[model samples]
Target: MTNGDDEGAAGARNRTVAVDGETFVYRRFGGTGSETVPPLVLLQHFRGNLDSWDPALLDVLAADREVIAVDLRGVGESTGRVRDNVTDMARDTIAFTAALGLRQIDVLGFSLGGHIAQELALLRPRLVRRLVLAGTAPRGGPDFHNWSDDLFDTSCLDNPTAETFISLFFSGSTDSVKSAWAYLARAGARTGDQDSATTLEVRDAQLQALMEWAIPDSSKLERLAAITQPTLVACGDNDTMMRTSNSNLLADRIPGAQLRIYPDSGHGFLNQYPVAFGEHVRKFLGQ
Candidate 1:
């Protein structure tokens, strides 16, 4: 449980709760400030589980307020069928919060997680206080629909190696790759009670969700207007997976949303710039 903020993410225990007959695994930690600051909920990328969160970044974000990182249904040790659409995923998350008795929360969604976060905020506006969208895009925006040929060539393998993730999240530049390896090392530092890997079912379902959600409809941008919560959109300067242009568009669409672009990074820029980005997030959250 990481009481008294002893060691942050790596030391946080895996907790369980039953939501609609589904046992969900999650890590809850760092709830150490005024009650006015709501907890932050993390939504992972496609095929990512609770362990997918970079410990360094988690520690940064959890410094003041509590952070809840879950394994979404059918991923990792969570017991349920993974859905083929973000709406169901969001619904599952909403149910999860109800089971935990959380009335208000802040959300940080990365990659495909960003999709679910958007729907969550829209569907349950009063529940979500603020939003952080990283390495993601809006519904039906440029470079949002479909995967690139390079991405198609690498993703959805039965087993993925460190190199597979390194290339997928960072650019091929010498520095970017170097940072990626460092991130891998830090993210893997948790020694015991680690989370399980996401299954192929989760992969296929998330891919199908992306296919349906990112179908480039400019008119859909109107949906962002409904998100009156303070928002922060962040990404790398060169995110091939979710192009940086999408960040610009996302921030533009969401009234008063701020955008940040990390230099010389890609989709995993938050991990690469954990210290800076974490501080930035904490400041934005203002705990």
Candidate 2:
């Protein structure tokens, strides 16, 4: 990836890396990490792209280390078929980092991106130094096979408006709703040279992967034990998407993993409490 001149996430321009005949678009912001800190690879949530990341969170996390968020294969400006399974998606992420010559890096994955992060750590343990799993669950995690009957109902929609995000990612509390709006306002700051909107095809492909991962199978939970790197499992106390208990399960299953749950928040806890969470992460990874 070419060096970016912009200083923050909102101003960071796009960069590309061609690997395996496919071009992947990514944004690398923040200056180099201080001391031994490595670059942090950010994985976007489901139906989200490079631009979908919360700028405030990125800016805070980048205060001490470089941050790189990439559009998943076949999503945003990236070119390729969207993989229908999390494992293949993880492989694509591996290829993207390998092409960039990243031998070892820290990772922060949100929602579906967290699923990919877990897979990445397990797929190539030595490649990742530290991990942060936000608003996500392990395979066969809580509420498995019962996410919601209308999951695809929203999936097929062409526009996921601000309200849609609020309903799904935020809690019903008055303060949480206000936080949602604030996060939305910050997220909209990036305008020029923006990444492409997520298409229905990419949505459906990721949905299929989610369904496959949500299938009822107790054996799948055991796979998380393979993750050997230092990890932080985080989410809101009222996560309707992945369920709060799932984050607890992830903390339990992953050896020596730390768990943090923000009260009065929902799936978008990191965005809601970006400052606290960002510092939490900075401290965790800095160690």
Local distance difference test values of all predictions, in order = 0.88, 0.87
Worst 10 residues of 2 by lDDT: 147-156
Leading candidate by lDDT: 1
Clashing pairs in 2: none
TM-score per model over all chains? 0.96, 0.95
| Residues 150-212, model 1: lDDT tens digits | 786677778989999888888778988888888888878888779888888988999999878
Q: Give the TM-score of candidate 2.
A: 0.95
Please provide, for model 2 over 118-225, each residue's C-alpha lDDT reduced to its tens digit, 9 standing for 90 to 100. Answer: 999999999899999999988887584565656545435688888777888888789999999998888887777699988988988998888788786779989988
